[model samples]
Target: MADEVVSRSYCCFVCRNYVAEHDDIVSKSFQAHTGRAYLFSHAVNIVTGPKEDRHLLTGLHTVADVSCSDCGETLGWKYLKAYEPSQKYKEGKVVLEKYKIVKDFC
Candidate 1:
């Protein structure tokens, strides 16, 4: 089987603003608190909220809570630091997924 191409767009459910295209969605995954979500390769016009330290076990690193830039609804997060020299590429990636946004119907 092949991966189906999603030909439509998705938006924040609260704001209905264009955030990501189907091709931008990198993959789908699950979490204990939020269940299923889609990780986008790129996110547009979003406001990343205040940065904070996370991952107590691995030592604290920076992250920001993400939100729709227009309506201020909580979306997901942006990883701000890998906390190490080699893994810095993890920063600036977004986690706005199916649970946080909806398919743009219009």
Candidate 2:
């Protein structure tokens, strides 16, 4: 018999739609309008809203709201563009509020 590995991921709190993989998390120290959030390198099953410039804690960034494709719940936002040179790494990344998702194992 061989040992099987379990994969961990995050799902939408409202509908349990798989949103992000555990391995894709880039930072856990992020803050959102509600509270703590996480930065992810990749996200799935989400719909991105319009892009608008917002002054974040780091700097001004062009961001779009991300919602669950299944339930249309506002999950978080996607970084479309970061104005600060040092914040450029965040562009194309996604931030999901800690309270908006639940841990899922498969």
Candidate 3:
């Protein structure tokens, strides 16, 4: 029999709603307001709040709070605009706190 490849993903810790695929992870060394976070190229099953400019560890960035659509739990933020040129790559990406999500296999 051909072996099947199991896909790994990250789910909302509060409701187990799949938010991001493991393959979409950009960085696992990001820092959030609470603790460590992961930068993802894309996120699903989430809703973005109002955009605001916040001075983060990196610099000033326009971000929007991201929450799980299922349970309305604040998961993290999505980078809308990065003021610093070096951080521009983060624009349009989502960062989900490590503690706010759980891993799942399928």
Candidate 4:
């Protein structure tokens, strides 16, 4: 027999805030709800502070609050660092193409 495995799509916990994922959270408040994990379409290093400059491209392992642009779905998170040299920091949103999903995440 051939090897068989199934990997489902997952969204960021932040983006999924106001969508169907939100309802899942509400329903399974106490229990671990792993039903609606979304497949992120992009990968942005989750950095804080300014939106410019070149820093270490260290990605986050956990989904630390990422909200989707469309329908407000929480996609996967990118581990990012704060844009130092300034406190008024802007968050980084990882951009991913539709096809890149397989190459990047998968």
Candidate 5:
């Protein structure tokens, strides 16, 4: 089971406490509608922000507006989109993957 985990979740480039395990990631290293890279997480520690139609692929998705649960630093965003029969898997998912995150330590 340990080999299946490709990464570990942490605070936004500050705190080292574990937030979410990589095992729950729906999509890893995936490209977003903004032409940027992101990881679709099943779990995260973030507060909801204003919903907007920023990206075309995600529709009018709300931002998670997440900061570090331990420290106040911009962590990531959870895309809250309207549920669809074909896209039900991405309804309550998060996007927080940049150099600022902890991917692997060993």
Candidate 6:
């Protein structure tokens, strides 16, 4: 059987960059957070591929790891993808799956 692809949006818990391309984390086996994990990104968008599909967009865009940079908190990710939803995206809270972190930066 194949994995099911989910659709959702992501907003940086801390930053002006609201929408991003990739938000959902691929492969649940991939480790992302040890303690309380947060979500953050540089851009936002809607994708139809799997969470492993990281290269949905192009250009110098692709925030591999997202950190607080201030307090050094391992946030979520910040990658490049399609534009986020406009006023229409306004809805209830959307839960997104976390991604796997191959490395980290402090």
C-alpha TM-scores of all predictions? 0.73, 0.97, 0.97, 0.23, 0.61, 0.24
RMSD to native, candidate 5 = 4.4
For candidate 4, lDDT tens digit of each residue in 75-103? 33332334444421223323222221221
* Model 4, TM vs. native: 0.23
lDDT of 2 at 28: 98
Candidate 5 positional error at 37, Å: 3.9
Output the better candidate (3/4) by lDDT.
3
lDDT score, residue 38, model 4?
Answer: 26
Off by over 4 Å in 3: none
**Clash numbers, per candidate:** 0, 0, 0, 23, 0, 8
| Cα lDDT computed for each candidate against the true fold | 0.72, 0.97, 0.97, 0.30, 0.57, 0.33
User: Compared to the true structure, candidate 6 yields what TM-score?
Assistant: 0.24
Q: How many backbone clashes does candidate 5 have?
A: 0
Model 4's alpha-carbon lDDT is 0.30
Tens digits of lDDT, candidate 2, 33-80: 999999999899999999999999998999999999999999999999
- Superposed model 5: Cα runs more than 4 Å off: 1-11, 32-36, 56-60, 83-86, 104-106
lDDT of 5 by residue, 7-71 (tens): 55444567654545666666665654444546555545555566664453645444455566667
lDDT at 5 for candidate 4?
55
User: What's the C-alpha lDDT at position 9 in model 6?
Assistant: 43
**Predicted structure 5, TM vs. truth:** 0.61
Error of 4 at 93 (Å): 10
On lDDT, the stronger of 2 and 4 is: 2
